[model samples]
Target: MLRRPQGNLSYVSGVTDDPLRFVTLSQALDETVAAHGTRAAAIFSSEREVMSWKELQRQSDDVAAALLGLGLQRGDRIGMCSANRREWLLAQFGAARIGAVLVNLNPAYRSTELEFALNKVRCRVLILARSTAAGNHLGMLRVLAPELDQPGAKPVLESRRLPHLRHVIVLGEGLVPARAERFSDFLRRGSANGKRRLAALAAALDPDDAVSLQFTGGTTGAPKAVALSHFSIVNNARFAARAMQVGEGDKLCIAGPLHQSLGLVLGVLTCVTTGATMVFPGPDFDPLRTLDAVSRHRCTVLHGGPALFQALLDHPELPEYDTSSLRTGIVAGAPCPADMLERAVQLLCLDELTVVYGMTEAGPVTFQTDVDDPLELRVATVGRVHPNIEVKIVDPDDRIVPVGRLGELCVRGYSVMRGYWEDAKRTRDAFDETGWMRTGDLATLDADGYCRIVGRVRDRVLRGNRLVCPEAVEALIRRHPKVQDAQVFGVPEVKPEGRSDAKPEGNRGEDLCAWIVLAPGAAASAEEIRAFCRAKGEAEQVPGPVRFVAAFPVTASGKAQKFAMRASMVREMKAREIKTA
Candidate 1:
């Protein structure tokens, strides 16, 4: 177990004894290919596409050269809108090789969101898949910028909606837009001269140069562009691999989308840095497919959130697949209830499961459980500070809080992002004078240097002038065997018309509302849930208005949309004339 910190202060800097390779992503790829020439670098199982390290290097260079041939300059932004596929990987590494920032467009984004992202980043080129099961991505693009669909006198697209966007490169077979080029034709356009220029540009690149732009999930508000450098993410991947003890020849199943930090920086980049083989089960995450990939490839590692694990465990055929090859992997991007973690370890044969805690602005991971840590620490806490990173808990006044006290989690380290892209005002608000990035997450540091995230700062509920943390109640609710998931929030007391009363009866200004998802084949009423809470929790911890919900609105990454749920509950209560306690 992680004991008390060596210092007297609340601050902790991860011990930096191990050397980190501070190299660009392109250089890292070259070095990996040099060391592991014929090793399987990437495998897209559904597509039956497998590339050796050498092949990845050559193909990435070809794409890089192609971008240069198309007049894309160094430092230009290129947007990609697609699911997890072989082409996404190619665009990611290829754009990095030429120092052009690859802007990851969420495949779930419609035309409006897509237009905002591209125009916000000033992307000169967009790489897209023609269609997906989710929607027709190309049709959405055409709807957003119709100039692309129209034949111009010179076959050029000039859209007021996307002034900076120049070319649209389609990945799959489809009707080519006037301003779009086919993926294969785009590749074939590269010349020997362009290849030579790509080599020179790679040689001139610096580790600190911003190589990629990942938009924040925008759950709280508008998604801001986060600029990440090669220095930040490359070293982050190195240390993350070290924490997981990933090594050469380890087959890692990547179930998350490649756009997010989890899949791009941690999953793919970590494998590149550690010489591990990356296995993509399919375009989207499927419990059965993930299990099949692990069994078929003997994958030693897997990456996903708690919901994905829950799905795997709930699958009827989970026992059919042999998962003995899964020695370790990450359960991150959302809260991992203790029961879920235990179930994963027991059923999936993952003896070394880690819980990683981070956000996009911090290179995605600043604290993670070590493979050797006790299961209690792994389940109850987010583990200790990461290597080469510094963390401190601070109160609202920005003063450092005492140990074991709840406060805002602050991080300062090599992995800290440069800033919100091109938004100086937002960037200035994100950090303090000392350069500590305020995480906006309420957390507590234990005496043993372990940290536990309680909730978001905005998630605090005000009840009778006292701050109530919904996560505390939610945790208690999740402990119920019949409860599959739970969310607790504060609802403003609504007064009846013509009442003109000081406040509603039994109202302390706010009432606690609970939304729950029952386990499969398990049924629980609101009274039963409240009774269970009363049995397990104190008076303040029990929710006043308990609600049973079949599902929750979530982001693409599976993060529960608490705000959306709150709005939905408010509407339901007003419509049903439900009274709160």
Candidate 2:
């Protein structure tokens, strides 16, 4: 058991004294594939399908072959959109196996919503799920097909399905009339024996080879694509799994979307490489269904954003479900409440809950408050850096701060992203001259190395339990006919009762609120704005407080002065409460 901080407990035990060679993600997966060829790899849901290690290998290989057949060359971008399904894994591994970069799209992104990402990434092939409990996938794709670049337009594809897009392989129920091939059909048409070829491809990949395009909330309305490679992803996952001690027979219930970092690296792949069973909530992400899945599946570990825990505890049916199987897991994407962590142990029977602090750029970076730590520390802190991670608190001048002094969290380790894809200016700005990746999160490391995230130094918002990608939200708002310019942020947070003080400017804190300027005569109401956000009954980066403006207060660079909007939110919330009262 992790004892109280009487003194610095020696953390030397978890580390190896010998030199260790970092394995790339492809190499890691390849080794696992060779070691556990026929083992049952993944299980989805009842009446749903399962993929054994052997089957997973063959399917991904076939997918790779089909992608190759389309003449998709190395380092080409392949975007995929799907709920938790067998094919999602196939697509991810298939793309990686053939040295193609994988770009994950949120399943909720409609065709109109996907266009920006598709265009931004210069996508070659898109593999998507046909349907889920939420809506029709084929319908969404068909909607996006026509928007593809015209012949001779930029952002080329592999098969040229939509003039600019090369091919579309439907993972589940397929899009007909659009002429996209079924994922299974595409797989079956190819040779399943690409073992030697895939290995050769893996050998060509180095620790720094960029393999994935993960978009994060950039400044204002620009989406920054974080390029992560096999080495960064695999090494980080390896250390994180060790820190969490995830192993066989452990059933991991994931409420986070499989598309995000929490879902992809920490949720899906972490479970897979660790031999843990990953259980995804069916469409709609209802808390009751999550509890039901837990009670029925006897899920031992559950990973969720902070909001899910709120819904789970508030769920009227929560008492009926058996959650005794739960022991340890995480509240990774956002800082959780002290009370919530308290209830997790005494009320919910969680052995422990980890407050993971990291971003898409660098993750599994700092893991705070282990399974055996005191409740207060676990709930309030993001713990310490994982065994392999190196974290330093640096001030604005790039100097290391004293213990407990809040500064930007700088990480130099396996979790650091390679760079922003094809955007050298952004990548250069992301880090200092040194190799350290500036996380832009304001945090303090206590004497014992526990990371306490105070707030963010960026204009983004960490709303509830999810990273409210303000850039994307603002971009969408900007595209509206009536909107001319906008800046978004997380407003006074309703999460974690104690951490209620909202900081509107500079990152590691606050909930989201947006300021918008109407085009000539375009006006909007709260209802219309919210209606625009509601999708499948789940809110994803839903905007709050449509602060209409004649103009956004700007800096010399013409950047929006978010602090002014921050002041507005404080006043608006106060006034709204007073009127309601």
Candidate 3:
């Protein structure tokens, strides 16, 4: 329930009878294992691997012991770059078991991104897959650290580029680098003595200790590392599990990337807290495999972003599989359209589908609709504040706004991140004077405390003195009969003929561009969409350019990359200018 202390102010706190859990992740996992030892903890459908709770506990202990054998200490950072797989979970829990922080590195990252993240966090150890559907992850590491190519090099890597990176553990069967150790060999390094050390470390672990570093989506700039504590994520998962009504025997098919908090905290940790079965459809999200897993395993819950759900809904072979087993799930990582939610309910049999709103910094979830909420409430709003969380909407001056007025969303509570990892300046800027973490999202709160996200503050486009919100435009465009999906962003304004690059008195220096993905067998021109938007939306909300594409460039977690789209549009505009000259 939401409590409003200041009448008409956009401030609300979630009041719940359930108290927050004070245990570390390792303790939470142990408690679940004690109760559901023989139950299936995880099932990798594509790999044909199933691990019971007892087995998961045993393997994670071995992982912890191996890290101890390698001379890793508490508060050290261990990076893992891989797709969704069993090793990901093993490494996650293993790192927590020894009080080490796990830095989740996206498998899609190349040399530059990978190097920056590892060096930023000062990672001492990295565990990565040899390859993924994205590309050769190991090859990128080799390019970043040429020392790995040297024959007869020691197990510890010594590189100038990645100075803090001392060890690289590679998974999958391949020609292992001389300086890098194979994952299987690394696990064997665990012994009875190392196990004793791991047990001792686990016993001394604190719930407030940082256990994970999640990088932001980097849509606007370089990604900031958000540090999360054991207490924050463990309680977050427990509360989320309660909201979805997850139980011990429930099976969840989680398709989001493990690098993001959506997958690791909400998907993996939720299962650990609830004693539910975590099901992976494949190493990476495959709609066919997901459908098959839901039918084959009778998965009770499903989780994915809007794009993933759309892929599943639009797949040609969707009707061939049974999705009736799916009852509840989360639609997050991007703004979800009402039509998509309705379609998912009718087609995917997700009667209790809820929309969640959060960022990587807020332990990944601050607001989520209840499973029993009406369809209109579920589709229109991101729901009320999460349990044990305080939320408020503030204007530019950081003053609280009136209810139902648009402003920046600020959050404070146990679920808020400890801070941006090791960056004091950014961390200081993330919160207000009273310690409310600024969420950087434009939103409005109703009297009932339901939050309606308008868009990101940085995402608003300035065009000829008029500010246009892309989310509003995109929502209007998606209502068109021919459009299946749409992403709106701002590109550099093309100067009129005979005008210089200098900004004129009234110029805003940006133009709105819309990328549209048409419905199957649908054909529409750019003018058609612009006209439709002009008819239904305000003048400032109508995009100038509309480009129809098969799909939008998205992050691994399925959020549309508006920055990438803007870059592509700018490049095309430059090409056109050169041609005209």
Candidate 4:
């Protein structure tokens, strides 16, 4: 249901792109950097080399010059496998500034995952981050080097590991192996001291040009390459800053991994656009280290995933740290149990906490809860869409659903991505023929125009000829006092005792499976939980038995992967059936 807004496109800022068509991400970056003198921006860190805005600007310039000097063209892919160090951001912004498509390589990715991503995108230059205490990154890259450079496998010059990877840059304080070049060496060769050849590299890039190939962490199998033009991400940052009310001199602490879209735009680019100071914990986020950074930086904002915030709250020594500086930022990825929100506001003493709703392709968009919203309302909704973004609820017949009814949430606007890189078929499938991106989410828009998510349409169960939403169980479980977090999914009914055995186990069709993380020291049995749900029961609402876990498996983006849980539950059921007499 589209709400009648007090304002329309005129309410948006810095989004006046070419009126004739859509602009890309590269175009936006060029404009933003030029707007703020490159010499004026800086990324602070604890390391020996603290980069000034000028140094960062010239370094990116030299990096882009080095990249271009290698003859990599506009459409060529440069894959990066690094953690959240300053160099990672430099490589990313540098590549984007050069009009070369930057692929954010996940450090958490094993060689198998990296192999799939690299080969899929024909990446020409590979950047690797050295190992850190959080994980062994460089070791993993070395193992995969053979597949990447080993020669004769492709039409490139010679046999090398990662055959398609012509150049590999390491961002670490270690000696480069015979196979790869250190980022320092590359920069040194590209330029002497602070001088830069920015003219050719800084040519006005088109808004529609391909700027990045971010991989979508598919809930099913291997991740797919999600393409974002300069405009898609830049516009998202521009609108998001307005949505969050970010201003100059604001201090931001980034807790989410920069590799993902939520982190990239909100954590990285938002600071760039607003002239905000961003303080990042070393490569991987450490809960203890994060608290330290907050205390020292006197952080004004904290944009974190639910997992990071939960872990912070769960820490036995939480009271020892100084968290009084936090004020406003986004909290999402996992469902923020209403209790977490209260603790954040009362304990962390934050001024505002917004729950963002969107994935990589769409950027960090669709809905955002207002900072001043009440606790329950904040817990229940992802809020309203920004001015430049358009959303609709459509039924199976492609008609828009009535207000307050659940339907597939679709988005159409500047934040929508161009398409999947090199995969037109998936790109076509992702959007309706008319161009609205199918969000695969089941949500209802209230009379007030705020949308409350009902469930993920992709996670629905076909129960006795009707679709049952698992999110109903999630909402119900969260209502319990002891339950800290809940994620629900359906297990397809198996023909117990074989298809020929008859009577199909009770005829309710499919069963619901819920994973619950309880509050510390609290204990509740399944029967008691079932009683709670039964008390709140409504017609046709399929409430499932709750399963307790110390912690749930999650993605890099901090989202619970229910598909894995579903598969594991199937195996557990099969084993139970075998053990029964």
> Over the stretch 116-198, how does candidate 3's per-residue lDDT look in tens digits?
99999999999999999999988888899989878763688999999999989999766788999999999988889989877
What TM-score fits each model?
A: 0.93, 0.74, 0.93, 0.86
Which pairs in model 1 have colliding backbones? Answer: none
lDDT to native, each model? 0.86, 0.68, 0.89, 0.71
Predicted structure 2, TM vs. truth? 0.74
The top-ranked prediction according to lDDT is 3
Q: Give stretches of model 3 more than 4 Å off.
A: 1-6, 462-466, 481-485, 491-511, 515-526, 545-581
Q: Model 1 off-target regions past 4 Å? A: 1-8, 153-155, 480-482, 495-509, 518-528, 545-550, 567-581
Considering summed lDDT, which 10 consecutive residues are worst modelled in model 1?
1-10
RMSD of each: 3.0, 11.2, 2.8, 4.6
Q: What is the lDDT of residue 369 in candidate 2?
A: 59
Worst 10 residues of 3 by lDDT: 499-508
- Residue-level lDDT of model 1, residues 103-139, one tens digit each, is 9988888666788899898999999888875688888
RMSD of 1: 3.0
Model 1: how far is 485 from its true place, Å? 2.7
Candidate 1 lDDT at 204 equals: 93
Superposed Cα deviation of residue 122, candidate 1 (Å) = 1.8
